[model samples]
Structures are given as C-alpha cells and as structure tokens.
Target: MGGNGKHRWKISFHRPSSSSSSSKMEANHHNHHKQQEEPPKDFLCPIYGALMADPVVVSSGQTFERLSVQLCRNLGFSPKLDDGSIPDFSAIIPNKAIKSAILHWCDSSGVVHPRVPDPATVEKLVRALMAEEEVYPSPPPFSSPQLRVSERELIRGVAENPPVTFSHAATELGPRVNHFYSSSSEESVVITADNPGTPLPFATRPLCYSSSSSSEITESETLASSIPNSAPASEEEDHLVRNLKSVDVVDQEEGVLSLRKLTRTREELRVLLCTARVLLALKPLISSRYAVVQTNAIASLVNLSLEKPNKVTIVRSGFVPYLIDVLKSGSIEAQEHVAGAIFSLALEDDNKMAIGVLGALPPLMHALVRSESERTRHDSALALYHLTLVQSNRAKLVKLNAVPTLLALAQTGSSASRVLLVLCNLAACPEGRSAMLDGNAVECLVGMLRRNELDSEATRENCVAALFALSHGSMRFRGLAREARAVEVLREIEERGSERAREKAKRMLQMMRGRDDGEDEEGDWEKALRSGGAGGVGRNLHGPNSTTF
Candidate 1:
C-alpha cells in the first residue's frame, strides 16, 4: 500500500505534457540561480557599501570611498568603516590596486567605469624618459596637445577626479611648465634622437594646453629661434617677454618662496630675482587687482630678500616704488605685505638710499600714524630705524615731522618698542638729538625704564644707547639725563645684562660721573659696582679720579 501511495504521488507530479514539464523545470532552475547571485564584494566600499570608483586605504587596513574619507577628515572625525571602526586619516593612501580592480570589474560587468588613466602608461613614460641607459625604445611622437592630455590624465588619475585635478595640476606644475614653455631643447633633443628628421613636438610653439592656438605658433617659433640660449636680455626685452608669457603668477610666487627657503644656489636666486622683476613690472596689480597674485608676489619678494644677492637684485629692479605705491593705495592686507617687504629690503645698507629716495617715508609715516594694525606700525618704524642709520635719511625724517609722530606712538601706542628704537637711531646725530630733546623723548624712555615695560632686550639696549648719546659730553645734557634718572637705569643694566650691554652701560655711567678709567687706576669702579648704595648712583669720587656732572 505504501509503494502504491508513493507511485501515485510521483505520477501526480509528472502528469502534465512533456514540453510543459520541461519548461516548468527550466523556469524554476533560472529563478533559483537568480536568487543565489549577489553583487561582488570586492568592488564595494567598506565604508559606504557602494561600488567604489575611487578607493583609498587608511592605516587600519581597510578601504573606503575617497570622498567619504575626505569628508570624515573635514568633519574632524576619524574615517569610519561600515562596522564602525575608526581609521587614521593622516595615514590614508591611494589604493591603486583596488581602484584598478574596481574599474576592471565594472568594465566586465557592463557598469559605467570612471575615466581614470591607466597608471601603467604613465609609469612607462616616466621610466623610459628617466632611464639610466638612454637607449630604450622611445614611443611614437605625440602632439603637444597629446602631451598636455597625458599630463592631465596623469594628474587626474592621481587626484581621482577631473575638475579639481586639472586646477591642482595647473597650479603646482610651475617648474615643469616653465621648462616646457621656455626651454624645449631637452624635449626636442629626445624627440629628434628617437626619430631622426621629425620636428620636435614642443619646438614650434609655446607649450600650452590650448590646442586651438595654431595661429600664434608661427610667432612663437620665430621668437624661440631668434633668442639665443645664453644671451643677457635688456630691461625692455624682459618687459616684452614677461607680457608674452602666460605663467600663473601665484604659482610662480609659491615656487620662488620655496626655492629661497630650500637652497641659496645662484641659479635659483637668479630665477627668483627675475621673477621679482616681472612682478615689479606688473605694479598696477599690487594696488587693487588680483589680490592673491599681489600678496603672493610681495611675500615671495620678502622671503627672497633675506639673501643678500636677492635683496640687491630686487632693489636694482625698482621694487621699492611698487611697494611704496601699495603702501599708499592698496587694501590694508596688501599694505601689511608691502610693509613687511620694505622691512626686509631695509636690511641691506645699500637699499636704504633707494628706499628713501623713492618716497617710502610718506607712506611709512601714513601707516605709522593712521593704520590700525600694530604690525604695520612696527614694521614701518623698523624700516625708518634702519633708514635713519644714513645721516641724510635722519634729516629727511626730521623734515617730515617724524620725531613728534614717533613720540606719540612711544607714549601711547602698542609699537612703543619699535618707536624707541627708531628714536635711538635718530639720536645718533646733532639734529636728531635736538629733535628728541624738544620732543621730550627722554621722558618717554625714562618712563619705559622705570615701569619695566620695555618689550625686549633690544628695546632696552637701544633706549640706554640713546640716553648715552644724548648726554655724553654736554653739561646741560648730563643734567637732563641725571634728572631723568638715567643713572639708575644704567646701573640696573650694568648689574644684570648682556656683556656688551653691561660694558656700554658702565662706560656711559663713568662718562656721566666725569671720570676716566685712567683716573680710577685702582679699580674703584669694581667696588662701586658691588655696592648697593642708592642703586650705585651715589658713589663719590672727588679726589684725583673725579669731576662732577
């Protein structure tokens, strides 16, 4: 009976037509297969669970979407995985292997693939061009536009996108672009050596990415051929070429500052100086146009001026006038950069005369009196200080009514230290001494000393030096110093100061007391220095070693 029941169930399962049964079995098998299929895990980002077009790896040994990781970093959080584990962002690296695998899988599975370049091609080109033996088989010549396209592709692949990548490449490719645009001899030689008799791809044009500039190619070729490799150019030639060149000034400025920081090689210095000249020629930009370009150029020139040769070159290029113009007409930000540039340029003794003659003082005085920025005021004062080391500059400053302006700052501004240093420099001459005395500079310096509010050792030293200069030989000046309590300050400095400061202080004190080292032959001053009576000001020497103040 059980066998008969099993036979009946089997017959019920297969009682339909043969074609219908086969078709039903086939449909069931297809549905089962579809139900078992799933998307490939390797192509999915561990963080976003989406197919990754641009995959990057972090230090925790996990892969994530590039945008997801960057977003996490921007939000000030560690990159998180789908499992909620945080990965270190700073150690994030490009997962080229995974990226290539993802593209491959997309291509095989009929999914839309990202437009990233094959890294293998770029690596091959880099290797062949930079090979140890120069005998490798060269690839066929690509057009200038093709070369640009290839570089663009390389940068895009590295950056993982198109638009951001293009901007970044154009910005950071300054040195390479300069090489291709201005000196194509190397590229030309390589192309000719690879295939004899073929014209170089970069030889007949300014190697720009714009493929539609054929009309200008003839002019570019003519200019390239006419200019010699080693000839020195006149200023007019420089101006013409600079106008013709299409380099990005902001990028070039960045390169210039970087070169100055890394090395002081003459070649780099020459390039930097040349860049400064070009920027100086574009002076109108410093006033109101291209704020980024103007600020970067100013900063680059400031850093380059730290080197003596660069400073000399920039000064000779007539940059002082541009800086002065900016100080007069630019935005406050630009004025600050110009002030800093002027201060750096003032370090060169030879630059002081040029700066003074070029009308730097009026803008500087304006900045000192009216600018709300303390840094601007400080830098202007410092430049004035360095410039006043030249006697004629001091006279010019006096004529500009600098004494009263600086005295006001010293009495009530945040730039008191810089003002006092300027006063010290001006006090080096007879006219400056009279100016300080009339402007009551002694009282200001004395107030600073008594309150212990001097900003730095340099400020204090300059203050003491100014006092010494003001009161060294004249009885009336000595009385002024004495009444202003200069002796008390000098004693304090002598007891605990730098070696040079102490020596200067002691000399000034001895001079104020009307005694010479020759008269104090027994080292009585040593005994006085140890004594604390009236802060060492009441020490009496009336016999052979003394005269009176």
Candidate 2:
C-alpha cells in the first residue's frame, strides 16, 4: 500500500506529452510578455525614461521625477526632450496625484513598483545627457589666409606673458587715451595712457588716490615700475596676478584694486579676468585684515561673477565659505560687497545648492536683518530669495527658524516685497508650510492684505500666493484663515487685485468655503500659482534694471 501511494505521487509530477507540453510553454511565454509590458508614457519622466516614483510639477507646469529635476538643476543643464521642448526647473511642487496613479498602475498591471534611483546613478545619467547637449557640429574649415610673422609673434607673446594692467594694455595697443570713470557719485577721473582721445567703454568706482606729489613718491616706485607700458594684455594680467600673490600689503591692495577696476564695466575683461590664476590669487585677500584689500578683493569677485559663465567657476573655486566668514565679521562696507557677491553667485542654478551647503543661509539672514547698509540688506534679501528657490535651502532656512524672522520682517514692513518673495518660496514645501502656519503666517499675510500694506501689486500677488501654497491640504489652514478673517481680504483681492492675484484669491476663498471640491479647482490653483508665484517675481526681481555694479 505504501509503494502504490508513492507511485501515485510520482505519476502526478510526471511530464506530459510533447504536443501538450509545447502548448503549455507557449501560453506561459505569452503571459510573461504581458507581465513585462511597458507603462503608459505619462507615468515616465522625460529625462529619466522610467516610471516615476516621486513625480513633481516644475515651474513650466510639466511633471517629472523629483530626482531627475534635482539632478538637472544641480548640473545647471536643461535638456531638450524628444519633442524638442526644454524644461524650466526654476521651481517645483510635488505631484501626489501622478505619483499615486503610477503606483496604482504598477500594481494593477503586475509591473514592479518603481523606487527612487541611486543618486550617484542619476547624476551619471544627467551628466551623460549634458554631454549630449554640449556636443555641437564642428565648424567648417577657416577660409582666411595664414597670419603674418609679426602677428604670429604678437600672438605668441600674448600667449606666453599677457598684459599686466588695463593701462599698460592701452599703452601697448596704441596712442588712444583711456578714460576711467567712477560709477559712484564721486568725481570721475580720466587717466590719459598716451594722449587725450575717444573714451573707452570701461568704467569703475573711484580708487584711493596717492596724496604725495609725483616728485615726492619714493617707496612704491619698484611696484609702479613692474607694470611697464610695452607689455601685452596677457603680460599685464600676469603682472597684476603677481602683485595679488605678493607678500607685501601694498602690492596685494594695488593688484586687487586694479583688478576690481578692470572688471567693473568691461564685460569682455570680466570674462577674461575670471581665470583660475586670478581667482586663486583673490582668495586669501578676501579675508585680509586690511579693510581695503578685503573689500576690493571681494568686490573684484563680484565683478567677475557678473559674467554668466564665471558664476559657477567662482563657487567651485571655494569662495563661498570665505564669503560667509566675511559676511559674519567683516566691516559694513565689506559686508555689502560680500552680500552682492553672494547674490550674484546665487543667480546661477549650479551654485545655489553649493552656496547654501557651504553655510551661507545663517549669515545671509543676519545680514538681511542686521546690516546697517541698505544695499547690504537689499542684496541679502535678494540672495535669500534666490537661494531658497532650491528645496534644500528652503529646508535649511526652516530648520534655522528663518520663517519667524522672515515673518517678523514682513510684519514690520522692512523690505516687505523681497521678504514676502522669500516667504512665498518657503511656503511651497511641507516643512516650511507647517513652520509658517505655526508662526501665524496666515494672520500676518491676511493683515497685510486687509490693510493694503504691501509695497506693490507684485508684492501683494506674492503674499496671496504664499497663503495659497499654505492652504494646500492643510487641516490647520482653514481654521487659521477663519481666525484671520481671510475670506474678506481674499474677496477684496478677487475683486480688485491684478489678474494673477485675483485668480489666486478666488481659489483661496473656494478652499475656505469648502468649494474646492475636485482636481479641477486644484488644477486651476496650480496654474495660477505656477504663473505668478516666485517664478514671476524672479523675472521682475532679476530684470535688467534690478541689479547694478
């Protein structure tokens, strides 16, 4: 009986006939293919080319994987997709709906759920895409004839040892006179290189003039003679670089001052002077105890950073930490220049994270609140506004208890417009929203709106936008809005505010009235928010007239 039972079990596991086996194999192959099917196009990130685990909507109203957006922003490379459209990553908001749909689809379709990719792997992919975009078709062969011997010799000389100073370059170039004008209110002076002639485009703030007569000069003659008139531009640059690297305080001061003047107004010179040699030389001088050397060195960096390409270069050279150090303890004038440099450097997408990571937020906040110079405060506010656009910086600011300080500034109406812009960015994140609500931001913003205390239409728009961001899915927002009488203020805004502000106010009122019933209203709110929030303010704030040298 035991043998018969074992035989029966073995028979149950035996293979079928070949024909039957082939049919079963075919069925299983079809099922396997079905299981391996691709996901819907909407579920995939344009850059990642995979189902998105954490989707987010960017400033352009397009959804992408959050990691992909971060990588692109960090790389400062906006890629063009297959459809030939470039993404704008200026701001991003979580797309929970899309993320949910993706996960549900994966479950229903028997596809494995997606996971957040390794950051190292994602960065590699982003860099590969960047490399593709940077590749351009080679230019056609040059049609011009070969150069003469003197021209070649001149080019070789420049390549070997460039000009030492702008004045020296002007002297070597020819008889044309160079006029140096101060951008400040101080009286401008035209230093004639050879003869009085047409004015060059270069201009800068006034430098400290030597008080002694030419006949009385004695100690600085060796330094003065170093920059000869016959040197080319490359040689002149080298000479100034040597002075910057010199041990003597006077040489360092003169080099930085000359560099500051050289880069101030000449856009071409700013690009040329932003080399590694010059930046490295300017590094130590940034922290010099001599106020003149420190201020001028930082000011020169600010000038170099005005060039778009040099922004990232300056940050990568490790200037941010030193800038923060000076911002904390330097003189008021030096802090003004440091703030400006920080602001200018933060304009580049690549430098934003690095700057914030190198510990710029606390000192920047301090400058925004405590600096005596209005320019310092203004620049600090703008720097904060730009820096907080990145999510990491926003989180860091919230951790530093920056929301309350910022709200205090807004309530007191000191730089209210700029301060509100920073608040608007912070309100986009969950941590920031909780912090602001805890800090009674709804009351403060509502009060500002009720009293018409905001500085401009754009400022009021940003204020409404902040409240709008705060109202998203927060149980605390409704009660807070009621306590602040936000409905009346929003109604007034809906009736009289600018188009963007009116739309946002209407949405906020809907949420308060429990009429924000579906995704349609939410979608409209996203549209309104996307069109006018920090992105719009950024355009106006960084416009042509916004910044000056």
Clashes of each: 0, 15
Residue 34, model 1, lDDT: 43
Tens digit per residue, CA lDDT, model 2, 353-377: 7677667899999988998776677
* Winning candidate number (lDDT): 2
TM-score of 2: 0.59
TM-score per candidate, chains pooled: 0.46, 0.59
Q: How would you encode candidate 1's per-residue C-alpha lDDT over 1-549 as one tens digit per residue? A: 111111111101111233444587798985585444334666565434456667765533456667655544433333222332234444456777678887776565445664432345323422332242222222323211112233334434535632221222223212221111224321122222323432212111111211223333333234434444453346533543343222444433444333322222233433433543343333334442555556545644554554555554566544676678788877665676677677767766767765675568888988988976655665677677667768768888888878888877776776665576677667667788788888877777767777877665545555565665555334566667777887888788899854435766787688778774534522433333222111211122111111000
Number of the top-ranking candidate, with TM-score as the measure: 2
Q: What value of lDDT does candidate 1 attain over all alpha carbons?
A: 0.51
* Model 2 lDDT-worst window of ten: 2-11
Tell me how many residue pairs clash in candidate 2.
15
lDDT (Cα, 0-100) at 160 in candidate 1: 64
